[model samples]
Target: MNFDLTEERQMLQDTLRRYLRDKYTTSVRNEIIDSDTGLSDSIWAELAELGVLGALFTEEQGGFGGAGFDIAVVFEELGRAGVVEPVLDSVLMGGRLLAAAGKSDMVEEVIAGALHLAVAHGEPGGRYDLDHVHTQADGDTLTGRKAVVMNAEAADHLIVSARDGDAIGLYLVAQGAPGLTIQGYPLLAGGRAAEVTLDKTPATPLGLTLADYEAVNTLALVAISAEALGAMETATALTKDYLMTRKQFGRPIGTFQALAHRMSDLLIELEQVRSAVINAAGNLEAHDRDLHLSATKNLIGRAGRLVAEEAIQMHGGIAMTQEYELAHIAKRIIMADHRFGDTDYHLERFIALSAA
Candidate 1:
């Protein structure tokens, strides 16, 4: 398969980059961080109007006949801009799961941007092993505790993975369901996450088969990995720019041989990670299940941490300051390591799979 960006994708990415750069400049992010609302609702509306919210779904589901690469383009731009939007959680979590489960009716509403949805997957334990879930779905009620649900409070709907009878399944829980309570919180990164507790909360079943569940979850992980790559790339560029302008002993600090070599090594790792992201994204529709996500997430975990640390080191004290973009970038990268699975987690899984 050819690894190339189509004309439409190029158009989509360039437009998003320009729009976000203007509207979500560093000032905007800083303001949002301090505001009563963690994010700008107006910006979210703009994204929906720009068709970005619906661009990853197919036309059959009321979308523009888009693809995963379409999502990759938008996410890359968002990462570069350090955007804090729930669009990723909306599409990657609820929208993809709906599509994977063949819920075309619900999928249409999501693609049309009428409903904001999130996946309440994480539990008391940090592990994302959905199949080993302890949450129970009893009739129309679900009882469980979910932590760090990305944009959970903002979601109109939530797709929760839980243990159903003898099988692991998904439950569609409305945000307004009785006995459901959500408390908003901030992630270590510059984004917001929520904790949701359900005590016999009313819910509908997604009825997705095991294959569909796995595919949707894996695709979400790969999507996050792509975003991580973008964050690292942006952080590295910012670091390099800072080094060139920052002077020591009446000369640009970047001229030092040791720092130059360190930047070079980090850049190489970034390129390798880019290749991994592209390969995994391209194979999102392919037959190989574990190989695609495992490779991408593992590479992202490694690259995200490595590049972020180097970027900080190059920026000196400024990098650690919360006011600096580098601080947010580094936080996002570190969170990515724990997002889908850290390097240690995915690497171990891959090794076990290889042995099997």
Candidate 2:
């Protein structure tokens, strides 16, 4: 039960950490977020060249690695840097879905960072249910609305989920397809999301049926849980540093027994989240993957909320300001809970899975 990363993964971790540390500062990220597309083509290309994108898929999928650990490693780094790119949406979720559907051409473009893709699976009032799809597909035409479609505006293609008869199916919709409209806006954290409107839009079927859709959705949960762990680590470290440095009543606030105790609790929660993420990642391909994923996401949602609250409270007003790094990380943790499934949602799911 060793948690140590393999040499290749460790190297990938180091390389990605260095690249993001040098290039993804708050100011640079701000510029990217403020831009028309809210993305950096140069940085995206750099990530592709560094094999960050390739690491999320296997050789069979037109890349080098596609294991659960690979996805966890890449996304953890992305979370650490608070990167606003659509790598999670495009690579982890959409690219993997394409790979599973045997869409080698699109997966290759994704690995090469030549194109962006997003999954438009969520809809208004869906309430975190992956199969609660209202979008309908008939004869290669899709008609429905998808809510919070991350990176849709910047995507070259969208892997949209739709109801085909009684089963869920995935389709590929090209950018600016007829009768397709995207209303893009910034997320509370850093990236952009769109409300996608499809009015009998033409689409290409991806050959993925209901079972594949469920599997991909569950994998997405594990990926984001790992990402949330990275963000919580950053937030916790930032809070601890602030406590150790910020003077209060002629001494550092960290010297106070009350604050020190609180910090210790945060560290314990962080460790718990780390363990949950590891467990979920390891069991991602197992038969009972849904059980592990639900449990992991539930723990992540709860622990992430605790970390976000404690970090913000410890930092006072500074952590709430957008100009600081912890604020964004905190936002990421808080918002990640809402994505995939929140604490209550996963908790209920875990209970049902356990009972069955």
Candidate 3:
């Protein structure tokens, strides 16, 4: 199948790239990360106005695009820019779940970027099991802990997952509802996550009970894998530029045959990642979507590690410094392995799916 982007997608990509290139400067990003909220309201509003948030949903959900490529196109740009916005947590994951549950009206503020939410589904030992929820739902109250809730600190509402009479269900818990606690901190990458606790917190049922969980998880995997692909591309380009500019023995290190060969290997790895991402995106709605998603994530985790490690080593000490862009990009690529499922996790998952 052809991989060429459609004209609309191409325009969206170009527009997002230009916007980030001009506004998402290193200093500006640093400030945003260092801000009290750990996010920039102004930039968030700008992205909304530019129709970035609207692209992740469909017309039924008040968005223009909700396909795999739409999610991939938007996330890849965010990854390229190393944006710290909560688009993934809010629009892609939480918002989509809300829409699927017939709570599309609730997401209007989110689509407008005036609100943010997080899916508090992961538990301390869930280990990538989407339905392994220990959160107990007793009538209208929830009680349990959710670990690594991305964007939780800034969330206006949390899409919480709990066991509803032996079936996993989602609840909408307001941020400051009684007995709710959020301990937020920055992640190894640029953004923040929170360890959330709920003690009989009042919640509203969203009318979903993990029935469409695979679709949600697969969609997230597809989006994040695309994001990792973008990070790898950036890391590769940055390393290549450094090799050409940094001189060694009165010659550019990239001119050395051995180093050139290594760069060639990196290029090959990048192409492999790109192909895997494309395959996953294309097969997002297929009958064997789980197999394709697991395979894509497996390749991404492994390739991301190689790209991150090689980029750092090639750049040497400077790459380890926090101020450098390569360091952040590398961190994102490596940390991406921990999200959804790691290399080994996905490998096992793919095998199990294949066997079935």
Each candidate structure's TM-score, on Cα atoms with residue i matched to residue i, is 0.93, 0.97, 0.98
Off by over 4 Å in 3: none
Which residue segments of model 2 deviate by more than 4 Å? none
What's the TM for model 1? 0.93
TM-score head-to-head 1 vs 3, winner: 3
User: Over the stretch 150-217, how does candidate 2's per-residue lDDT look in tens digits?
Assistant: 99989999999899889888999999999999999987787789999999999999888867867777
Top candidate when judged by TM-score against the true structure: 3
lDDT of 2 at 52: 95
Clashing residue pair totals per candidate (backbone < 3 A): 0, 1, 0
TM-score ranking from best to worst? 3, 2, 1
Question: lDDT (CA) for every model shown?
Answer: 0.79, 0.89, 0.89
Clashing pairs in 1: none
1 or 2, which is superior by lDDT? Answer: 2
For residue 282, model 1's alpha carbon misses the true position, in angstroms, by: 1.3
Q: Clashes in model 3: which pairs?
A: none
Give the deviation of candidate 3 from the true structure as CA RMSD: 1.0
Prediction 1 global C-alpha lDDT: 0.79
Q: List the pairs of residues colliding in candidate 2.
A: 57-65
